[model samples]
Target: MKKHIFLFAIVCITQFIYSQNDNIPEKKTQKGFGKIDFLSIKMPETTIPNESNMGFTGIHYNLMMNDWSYAGLGIYGAVTGERGGFFTLGINAGIKKYFTNNFYLDTGFHFGGGGGKSAPDGGGAFILPHFNLGYNFKDLSINSGWSYVNFFDGGEIKGHQLNVGLEIPLDFSYADYDVAENDYSFDGLQKSNWNVNSKKSSLMLHLNNLEIKGDDTNKNVQNFGRATIRLAGFEIASYLSKNWFTFVKFDGAYDGIKAGYMDVFLGGGYHLPFNKNRTNILAKFGVGAGGGGGVDSQGGFLIYPDISIEQKIFDAFFISVNKGYVMSPNSHFYTSSYGLGLKYYVERNGIISDENSFSEGIFKGIEVITKQDLYFNAKRDGEPTEDMHQISVQINFDLNKNLYIAGQTSFANFGNAGAYAEGIVGLGMQTNPFINDKTSFFAQVLGGAAGGGDISTGEGFIVKPSAGFNYQLNNTLSLRTAAGYVKAKGGDLSSPFINLGIKYNLSFLKMN
Candidate 1:
């Protein structure tokens, strides 16, 4: 089945990419507002075996189209019912139907994979269909309505519930880099006229070594031993001021610990520059959630604080070293950690205004893709070989015209195994377009932490290698498909897989 899917994906990709006409239309891009929403849902007596009510917290970001339709990604995590580590990540799309005077109906659907804490989310495939009656005030809106949650691949968890949510709209601007460079006017500074003055953003990757605090004294720590554990993670930062910034960070265990351990933090930091603007001293504080790997994290809530020094190395790039402390305010998990990292400064594209955002520049492009994967004959602990399905979101940052860095997060959506997930980072390269400039070939290799779902990914380290073609649909959208092999480094899990995806391309221009 997996092999068939792979061949089918290859054929589809080839056909789509090579089918473009010689005279493709000139793409007219638009400016719009994106949105981020916070949501909550409660289920009654729906949990498997225990028949307990469950509570979930969700976050999602969407890009609004010219017609007000939107598509994006979302993640939901269980915050109650002893399901702290249970979470799902997936793609979403819907629209808002407006009525009279600030009132509207928001409807959408979420489909993804995830499960944890022995929940019967068989294969982790789930769907959520919902609708909300909302009222908008300026840039914010509040709503509540009915939602149906079901893990349909092979699970007994299903229920209907009331859902409440809040939405905040944000600035979004996009254009094809090549088109913008050739068509837009350039100012005295050699920057495009569509460029805006905004704060720079950053992406950083780190390797951390943590020493468990009071391993023998703390039961949670004792269960995992006093040995140091190594983690790999990434951080994203957006400046609020010259010296202040807000950041989101996520890390997963890959060495000296089980693979299922992971944490995410949201926090702020201050940076002080020195040494002729080449060095910076930073202090950061963060609080968020974590759990799994048999570590008690008190419902997955945690706090982390750290300090570091960053030294500029090249254009828009830096190197850093940091020391930090991690602790669960409500549990016995604590650690003192040190790590190294690589940082890249990203330009914010577009001019901000009251109603829209516009940014045009010749800059590095970024591609955001959502993919569905099928794995064949995948192995699991004490279970027979079975086919599996997964949903993943991948981000690619261009290094040049043909090379890029990629990061991805994946969750199992089917195959009789729930709570399965993977986080990966790697590098890729693409060939120039052929067949009337519509298609391109690409290849990449990724490795990272993967475990859970009873799959035999010993210690949670796995690697994937894939090759595919992308078919450009327009200036901002494309179709992608790939065939790959996934194998665990320390476990017996292995499989051949196929991926189908949709890609959105945009540029993050340098601050004007």
Candidate 2:
């Protein structure tokens, strides 16, 4: 009996040793590192300071490595001089590859140029080849690069850039590793978790611009309006993480009336904490060239960065303060807009986990808004009109985080016997269903009501349904294409519209 008991103890000890060995992390002979890395570059600090001679200073980012690259499609403009200024607009694309540790080669191209009536008014393209050398020590990294810029018009600009930056791990590596080791932990011996409190930060230097877009319609005279404007020439900016960022933005818009050169703005602000999770908030106070158009008649250079807030009251309810200047060729104006927004999550987590569990859920939300124009004029063939006022409400709902429907109602009183009400409804679906994730399909159906007077006689309705698909090229940008049909009830009018646009995810602001 004693011999048998001793043998049992020896077998139990052997099984314990085997279990301990199984829990240890296996030593990988070739640990593959991430190919995509964020490299922060510093902007030029010294500026050729002169009120008339605009200078730029800020940080930029160059995201190119291992035969991979990125490009941005946007617009920019600036005003400089006493009586006349210049404007430039263009797009840029770049590529890069790393040959060894701390050594890489990069190439990029850009096209755009503008100036005053008598100044250099021309557009051209540029190609730049650069070299980068840097050391990445754990979370901190320092890098420097030199580039040779060649222009299509036989011009050349040589420059150098340097940057020192840090990256913080925003997730629990230990927890993640344990879960990964256990193959998603179906045995209940381990748990998978995410560190929601982790903060991701970055600082960079680069050239950038400010942009806005919208459309308006009035039923009194069967009139519709659409406008888009790009502000800021080539100016440097310092983007600090997702919470706080600042930029020294410039402006140059030339419509024959307010033609003058020299417009510069500089300022920054912090995110207002309104939501406990910090996913929603007010991004108030960015002092820079206020919105609006015309060379000299734009909003005052100082105190122009408008104030605004965005909040998610609940999963489906959203609110925002959409104020600021929307530049046009006629004059600089101010728009005060307050509205509620909504979002609904439908059918989330469609992919099955290793444990045969599928994580899925739904979300929905809404928003109401009213907007008024203050001290700004509408231009009818270069002439300014009285202040304009508009009020609108928008509603949105998601069925399974994949399918959604939206509706909007707006009332505009131009203060000229031109009061009208407009209503719109739409439906959309996503090919990929995930929160803040990308989708391949985004189809919609829309219908609207327009016309002045009582709802019976002078009432007109319009129906439009659109089908579109979006390919998220990356985390920050997406490429989309849409086509739709339009039909009217009161008027014998029908048409089709096709649009291809890019949408960018700006800093995720918070709400109170």
TM-score of each: 0.85, 0.37
- Top candidate (lDDT): 1
Q: Model 1: how far is 320 from its true place, Å?
A: 2.0
Query: Can you list the residue pairs that collide in candidate 1?
Result: 123-417, 125-413, 350-359
Q: Give the TM-score of candidate 1.
A: 0.85
Give the per-residue lDDT of model 2 (tens digit) for 420-493: 23345666775652445455676777664432211111124556677776656664356666666655554433
How far is 38's C-alpha from truth in model 1 (Å)?
A: 6.1
List, residue by residue over 123-192, the lDDT tens digit for candidate 1: 8988988898989887788888888888888777787888888787755555474432222323321333
Off by over 4 Å in 2: 1-91, 95-105, 111-190, 193-283, 287-292, 295-312, 316-318, 321-512
